[model samples]
Target: MNKYLRRALAPLAAATLGLTLLGGTDAVARPIGWTAAWAASPQRPSEGFTANWAEQGFSRQTLRQVVRVTQAGEQARIRLSNAYGTSPLRITGATIARAGKGAAVEQGSVRHLTFDGRRSTVIPARGHTASDPAQLTVGAEESVTVTLYLAETTGPATFHAQGFTDSYRADGDHRADVSGRAFGEKTQSWYYLAGVDVTGGARSERPGQGGVALFGDSITDGFGSTSGADRRYPDALADRIDRPVVNAGIGGNLVLNDSAWYGERGTARFERDVLDQPGITTAVVLEGLNDIGFYEAQAAGYDRPTYFPAPRVSAAELIAGYRSLIAQAHERGVRVVGATLLPLGGSDHYGAHAARVSDEVNEWIRTSGEFDAVADFDRLLADPADPERIAARYDSGDALHPNDAGYARMAAEVARVL
Candidate 1:
């Protein structure tokens, strides 16, 4: 037997025995329901891979990260990604368990994760793989720690930078460790792992059994929120709604172009990040800030040439992009909730021209009648004294993203609309 399977048998046997003793037969139940409990948008490897990734290419290491599940389930599985890798990625072993404090896992709660009943699997370049379902029961609003052992030499790793939570790493294989002692280093980013799905019925079949995907930029990615606290607007919204709220926001993401540090453009990634999410019946779009800000900087005579080639866009062009997303979502029977662009007048990039453009876009988002519904984010964050600028209490000092209090307001606004 593989090393991973051998190490995992003890915990798996223990869990099974405990379940049997407790009269828990849900693991063997038929017609399993699968819903997304948590999700993160994957982006291409950063240019500063050597500094950011920490581990060297061809070296062996284990990565462990904790994520909060918005919906509970009887069984669970994880998705590993190599979406932007230049070479095949090999996973020697993987495991998931209930999180205990920092990097530790609750004793006896660990489960061995596999792919097609195999302990090890190789994912091809630009591909993603899902683990075979494991009998790991997770509850709503609970934290789960996932550990993966990368045993082969891989190219620049695909990762999400602004996780707003701490992830741990250690040398050699520690995928089955129940304690955080082996984890000697810490980072605030998620690598390889993408989505976590738990088996369950639809919302109509079972209460609190659906999902909402937040398609957005840095604001939605929890850029300024407290790390590891799950204070993002979507996180707050998840607490209010009956469905799981998945964060698909990539920091610095753009709608019209792929000029940001993260993955593909918003329009290009909607299918994989939103449409493909399990049990996602609704998607809230809070993008276009990056797209608008980039050009705004150029228009204000900021001479940073090599940053990004500014694309001249009109309010009409942005509306067309929103329309395409709406059409795609409608085709899949998914409701698209359009969010009005927030105030940006106080930021360095904002000028009279950019303000005019923002006004135009927000105007259409409120009155276009193109989206199934609208979340008036602009009205929620804008200062009444100076309608073009963010309220002083809501600004996160950058004049762009919102503070935690601001995120709470945004979440409350979404809840009202839902």
Candidate 2:
């Protein structure tokens, strides 16, 4: 018990510990990095695929996206979507492989994917399925190419980029059996692929995890980021942060309840859109203007357009809805950040009506103090003098969605808050 006696025994204890290290039977599991994760924003067609529209362009083709992995690990999952295609979207074959060498089909490793019941089958449109977690290994900062072989086409596709992006074109038709055709990668094009949901770590532990929930309209759904660009604001934010981003933005989604655009406002779907996320920690909301514009139109004397009219939501109503949304999110411990409505002054989609409603909503978002934080997408990309217009510099031609540069600006501004 004496200090000198204890000190004398310390070396014996230390030596024994070292000897145990050499012969001990105990083993520790390596930490596998697995943390909370979510997709940035999700998009589906306004209407699920129907037989009538099959002639237009309804069909399930191979949908793929490249996931850039930060640290190599041994387990992973794939979040496959049938969110927009009509009819059950079936997957004939799915695989994850290392990026191919060049224009050739490069194969590194392969894994089979399954649906609710079958390995090769269809997923109901507007529904989703996550592949069973698989055991595999990847390297630090490596890229995994997830490729899904397509079945027959039956409905119009709700692809990643609604606008335009550079894509490959084969000389002859190449949809039926694309087994050995040489492929091309357009470095500067936009891609319709949503995102890759992955899980990994060292040892038996999970990975360091964080996630982003992208809540907005079609823009957040990635309408205009360069095709294959993978540069939606949410994607941009996700790539910069050490977190998984899941996009919940649906085109034509409103903030207040409405019969049009899927029978309700974005709020109605929040439970499914925001709460249902696998592991969401941070969420960014960009809505309201749609409600204001659409509702206000009917209120005015504008006849229900056999064609259409401008948006008509009132400022007070939109603000109140936002308040409710904020309160609900806080209750769930999810940080809700507001996004100012972007300009649509020149959009042929809506006349001046939606633009005015947009102005009212943006004003409230900037001044209301109703959210945990605000992402001023309007200030970042709007025309300074007009305020109602997207800066000519940032407009994506139609003047509704932001161009690549415009998206970049929006992302940079949002990143500041995160």
Which one is best on lDDT? Answer: 1
Tens digits of per-residue lDDT, candidate 2, 87-120, equal 7766675655554432223443556555443566
**TM value for model 1:** 0.89
Worst 10 residues of 2 by lDDT: 11-20
lDDT of each: 0.79, 0.55
Give the clash count for each candidate: 3, 60
Residue 320, candidate 1: C-alpha displacement in angstroms:
0.6
How do all models score by TM-score? 0.89, 0.67
> Which parts of model 1 are misplaced by more than 4 Å?
1-30, 48-51, 54-58, 201-209, 299-306
